[model samples]
Target: MMETGQVRDFAVGIEDSAIEDLRRRLAHARLPEKETVEDWDQGIPLAYVEELTAYWRDEYDMRRVGTVLSQWPNHLIAIDGLDIHFLHIRSPEADATPLVMTHGWPGSVLEFADVIGPLTDPVAHGGKAEDAFHLVLPSLPGYGFSGKPEAPGWSVLKIAMAWRALMAALGYERFCAQGGDWGSAVTIAIGALAGENIDGDPCRGIHSNMVWVTPPDEVMANPTEEEQAGLDRIAWYRTKDHGYSTQQSTRPQTLGYALADSPVGQMAWIVEKFHGWSDCGGHPENVYSRDRLLDNVMLYWLTNSAASSARLYWESFNSGEMPQIHMPMGGSIFPKDILTPSRRWAEKTFRNIVYWNRLEQGGHFAAMERAELFVEELRAWQRAATG
Candidate 1:
């Protein structure tokens, strides 16, 4: 293990050879036959994938990934024998609160691209200076530019502790944590562990867009309309949308061979989730641009991280029972997300709930699909947590 305080500046620099290789691969892609059905039930349509790949091979700017990520100050710090790549963007406001926002699977720091400007410089985005945050956006281990874990045991709790060490190394004695998807699990762990510390709590509070909560037996016996709808959503996910998780959890290495070797395979695998999980009527482009979607895909493709990233599921999928979070916590439940636990259900695990809301719009990729709403939710949670 290396000292966590040794931070080094890093940059996104994909070589020209890699770009040529990707284009060559896309040109000679072997696409499967179209789905028998016209809808996305079978996964991302073959026609759309062809169309997107054509654009990606020809028109999509190869330099966009570097350009977009270069807007912020990127860095790498050693923690637990891994090089953690993160974007440390400080607010113009000297008194801004420190916040560490995490991303989940099939998502990267790119998910927060639209909201970074607004959150870090509120005045520029027509918000109050007091609402600004000195943001820390990390690429999860085995994802993006971060180093893949060589051994097992880099579970959600371990990642949370690494994040805590990361914040402390950056001189944030106290900070707020925010996340969604797997990120929610990590943030919840941070909140749960804060109570066990003999020293002062490192995390001031935590917030999540995706909260997974099982209603108690009494509540499940007679769920409200919203609760019933949430239950239905859970059922839909487990039955219809959980094949990926099952594969990733049990045999990520086997699945990763295809995803890692073929760019088109990786693209279809991830883009399908964007379409199914987002508020997009039927197409992912309704919520995200072709370039933005490709930008995220490129992270996994360029890094060849399919097996390593999926291994997170293998490591932490059955994370046993949920740890009770006594710290001030907030929930922003998007209806179209995989799980939209109601306040009643969420309160069972998140004891000191400071904020909770169900938005009429948005989905799993809350920050990417609904950037403004996501930012507002964080600001609101901040106010509630502090006030």
Candidate 2:
């Protein structure tokens, strides 16, 4: 029996046996022969996967996820019949603004680990008390420690509404939203549905690292240098890197069997994204350590959430029409993201553009790869939105 809407304390507690089982699976992982190509064009090279698997099995600290996340107060609250897990960290500053940040696929709550302190306790992290935020970091349903959706229809919009319920249950009347990757899609949905009141609660604004918008034919006909670069990136992704998305969106269950059964399979599936999407300079290790990467992979491997998480793609990948958002919205466009929409293109959907900037460095995993910049962008957006 579960109590709906009750905010109960939750701690990550993976059994010792689960840890042993993961190592055993890694030990017996059956790998294929190395790729013929020297580069990642054929997919993540066999050698790199072998190297990562060895480190994961022999050297990586299995308890790192618990250790890193234990600093925050974790909680679980039932939202729309599913138990949602989140870290609700209040700032020491009395006037801190309430902000809900979401993480996307291939990313977990761990993505914000480095920036949590800076965002919640700005004074301690070389910022003013006014910049502090009461942060709510939720693990998307079916990912990490959150309960999986037993039925379909848990689309981005549904998740957005559930987040509203989650925040209202926490006593927040109004809050801002931020996200990247699929988190960006969720944040966009939140902004679209902001008018709906959860006991007078509303999402006041949104900031996203990944902005998705369709440019007008006129703009595409004669794109500026930066716009053209963004277009080229999109084209490249569609041609070279969209297979995983196609598989997940259309046939996640089939892909999930392998990912759920093999730890190395799960690791490689995600690590390739970290490599391709981040500003890693051709190697994922350029931006993230092996342990950090494993921390995210462990979330999926331990929970056996490969198929469940991928179902989100099937549910919302072609989310038909983009809703018009008139509320204050901000975007931080990173150079190396899969989709880099310029301000002109984004203005098509986001009517009230409060703040927009093109970052010099970073990629899809902004918070994880560039913590300082990600935090600063949020703070800057907060000032612009509320100022």
Candidate 3:
């Protein structure tokens, strides 16, 4: 059992210093000249950055964003000297199952703002009573509002324990867990750790959006026809995708300085992701309104958390013990998800592969890109798994 301190306050108003810092960085920003690269083929363009910066300075309202989120019941709790921020929405119905959904990199609890009410209190939100769920959305350690880990061992395994402690701290004994990206990895770790409370049985089951695995170098290198296909797929992702991880894992301090300084740079970096990995194909704005993009970027900027969040890559790469998840599991696999893990690979790891989905549309931001599809898929899996 874990002890909880007083509920922490929501981030409603930005201090003058934060705004001053943003302005100072933008003013001192040593911008590079535009390259021959015409499109986002070389990441966010210099011209686009200037345009967005103008909008941010002239029009965006931090107070308005804060007020909109204030409609919910949000709180932060300190456990083991780390401040963890999360939102709790209880089901009006007495017997609804509680499902805790966690997000991955470059995101915050803001990702779920649009979908929480619909999931938590479906009846009031004009959905069937059967679809209601109690949602507990938390910021990952060193991400967004959560305090950065002071020690090295706060890897996925430790973070899993922290989450279990968090859920238990809030008085939830048995709950379903869902996540995509690192979120999915943590959910798998939760089920593996189980009730040991780290006392009795590990926790209940977990539902996931992505799984990580590295094949034995021998077989993976000299692959069969089928394995060759997976290898080729992975290589494609590496060339176009792994650059960000490589930079973060190796030289985070250098990159952090720039990302932490300029809000315009931060927004461009984060927004480009919504464009690249979402169903909008190229136009990210189609899936995430400017309000949504700003909300996520604001979580990073106001809290000055861009660097700390990037440290997860550093921690994981160093640890090198990517555990195979062998517990009862549910999966929500999206098509354009960089490198979608194979079912053959997943089945080897997850003990009970109860629910497996290959979604038709939607991409990296499954919940945000296709909320209706994401929710319905989750509901379908939960119903089948628990029953």
* Candidate 3 residue-wise lDDT at 174: 71
lDDT of 1: 0.91
Off by over 4 Å in 1: 1-5, 196-199
Which candidate leads in TM-score? Answer: 1
Query: How high is the CA lDDT of each candidate model?
Result: 0.91, 0.91, 0.74
Structure candidate 2, residue pairs in collision? none
- Give the runs in model 2 whose Cα sits over 4 Å from its true position: 1-4, 195-201
lDDT of 2 by residue, 1-387 (tens): 123588999987888999999989999999999999999999999999999999999999988888888889999998878989999999999789999999999999999999999999999999999999999999999998999999998999899888878888988888999999889999988888855342343777899999977776856999988899999999999999999999999999999999999999999999999999999999999999989999999888989999999999999988798978887899999999988988888988888899999999999999999999999999999999977
CA lDDT, candidate 2, residue 30: 99
Model 3 off-target regions past 4 Å? 1-11, 20-30, 195-202, 215-233
Clashing pairs in model 3, backbone N/Cα/C closer than 3 A: 194-202, 194-203, 195-201, 195-202, 195-203, 196-199
TM-score, ranked from best to worst = 1, 2, 3
On the 0 to 100 scale, the lDDT of residue 256 in model 1 is 92
TM-score of each candidate structure, all chains considered together: 0.98, 0.97, 0.89
How big is the positional error of residue 98 in model 2, measured in Å on the Cα after superposition?
0.5
